[model samples]
Target: SQQGEEDPQALSIQEGENATMNCSYKTSINNLQWYRQNSGRGLVHLILIRSNEREKHSGRLRVTLDTSKKSSSLLITASRAADTASYFCATDAGAGNQFYFGTGTSLTVIP
Candidate 1:
């Protein structure tokens, strides 16, 4: 299957703290992308790391990929209340117009 699955379906952390989530997939992929959704807002892309990449970072977010294990991890450092949202991991199947996403991890950054 192309779908990725993330651990810790939910998490709650204090503002200024850090949160981490992991994702695992079953098929080969061209790239993996992370997205964040706040309440009813549309998802916003956080970062995309190609299959050839091992690690990538954007602002306070860091992502690591282990192709051998078909797994990836996302780390949010110094998270704020504004960071409260649902995070999802998506994989491009390398085929045209094909992508799959995980169920998502619900995060609440408490102030």
Candidate 2:
């Protein structure tokens, strides 16, 4: 297994519905972070759930971690056109605690 490998390489959802994506890793982590990146834009930090946390939420975003399974999921409530972007999971687990970014889930929220 990779350090961070996200599931559902692509997703399409209508506005107002929720979107969910999962990520799995192979190593223990200090924290796992989610990020959003608009096409041709820089990444925007979404949320960071620590190893001790089971879940965390921010605004319409919710994140859950299961260390035993080395997996995590991110859910965005009330999808919007503006939310169309690529979502990625990053873990602070590699050498020297560097971050490992996964292949993201590209989401298109149609209005």
Candidate 3:
């Protein structure tokens, strides 16, 4: 079974709105990362939060990690129509330097 799974299968929002997504994992992890994928395109790394870090922000993206709870969240503020994309969470458990990914959350930002 995969280590991580994201909540909310899909989401729709208007431009200028905010979008939030969550991810849960089964075991201890060394780090967590979020990526954005536009339809029919490769993914782009958005943010990465290490186990020692509680939160991090890059531009409009905010990521929070709770190692104790084995959970993490990604928040995007002031989303734009171009922000419409599928988001995925990846977890690294320090096992062979491999990372497992969540199913993903599809976000649609309407103009």
Candidate 4:
């Protein structure tokens, strides 16, 4: 499968702390995207890094990609209780508009 799997199905951290999640896929991909979903809400796009790129950052979020290992990581620094959400890694397998999402890592940032 071209789908990726993320480690640590769930994580809990205090506010102002850092959270990290890792994902590993089975095939080459065009791009990988991270999304955040709050309870009962649609997903919000956090970041998207292409295969040729190694790392990218936005605000308190940092993402790293290693194509050779078909793996990726996302780091969220100084997280807040508002950051509590389910995070998913999605990969575009060079196909149409389809993407395969990881099982997801549920993060809880306690205040």
Candidate 5:
């Protein structure tokens, strides 16, 4: 895996359902973050998980990190139409404070 490699190129789901995505990284990271973008626009930070942490959640979003495997996953529960967006995982190596983003997963939520 590269610095950021998200699985599932695209996804389609109905409102009220759940959407899950995965990401794998190459080198060790200081922290991992998840972001969302709508309509090919700017990205919104969703959650951030430090290498020392295992899992974190905010509202309907849950993020998990497995440093041993160098992987992470994001789960959106009770997904809404507004949840339809591109999801990306980013890694921060703590080197110059730069973040590298993944390929991204396009999610479509039908209402």
Candidate 6:
């Protein structure tokens, strides 16, 4: 169980359905980040929630962090076909500006 390593390596959902993914990490962190990457493009920042924060939201994206459980979850509501992409979670340990990334979740929103 390394830092920022999470589950559900892949996910598939229909358009208009919601999608959820989880991320877990070890040790203390300053903030957790979620990113989305298209097939061959770079990652796009989704959201970042601080350690002191329980949850945050941006548009159709909702993020929750529980330091007690050392885990975080991302929820995308009313998903769309254009939302199809691989999502990765990142954690900034706040130590020397280092960040750890999760394996990533491949999401396919079928029309």
lDDT of 4: 0.94
State in Å the error of residue 66, model 1: 0.4
Residue range with the least summed lDDT across 10 consecutive positions in model 5 = 91-100
- Please give the CA lDDT of all the candidate structures: 0.93, 0.94, 0.91, 0.94, 0.92, 0.91
Taking the tens digit of each residue's C-alpha lDDT, what string does model 2 give over 1-111? Answer: 455999999999999999999999998888899999999999999999999999999999999999999999999999889999999999986453478899999999999
- Model 5 TM-score is 0.95
Task: Report the C-alpha lDDT of model 3 over 56-107, residue by residue, as the tens digit.
Answer: 9999999999989899999999999999899999988857388899999999
- Residue pairs in steric clash, candidate 6? none
Q: Can you write out model 6's per-residue Cα lDDT over 40-72, one digit (the tens) per residue?
A: 999899899999999999999999999999999
lDDT of 4 by residue, 1-111 (tens): 777898889999999999999999988999999998998999999999999999999999999999999999999999999999999999998674789999889999999
Query: Root-mean-square deviation of each candidate, in angstroms?
Result: 0.9, 1.3, 1.0, 0.9, 1.3, 1.3
- Off-target runs (Cα >4 Å) in candidate 1 are none
Query: lDDT, candidate 6, residue 75?
Result: 98
Q: Considering TM-score, which of the candidate structures 1 and 2 is the better prediction for this target?
A: 1
> Could you give candidate 5's per-residue lDDT for residues 35-109 as a string of tens digits?
999985999999999999999999999999999999999999999998999999999885737888999999999
Q: Candidate 4: minimum summed lDDT over ten consecutive residues — where?
A: 92-101
Q: Could you tell me the TM-score of candidate 3?
A: 0.95
Assess every candidate by TM-score: 0.96, 0.95, 0.95, 0.96, 0.95, 0.95
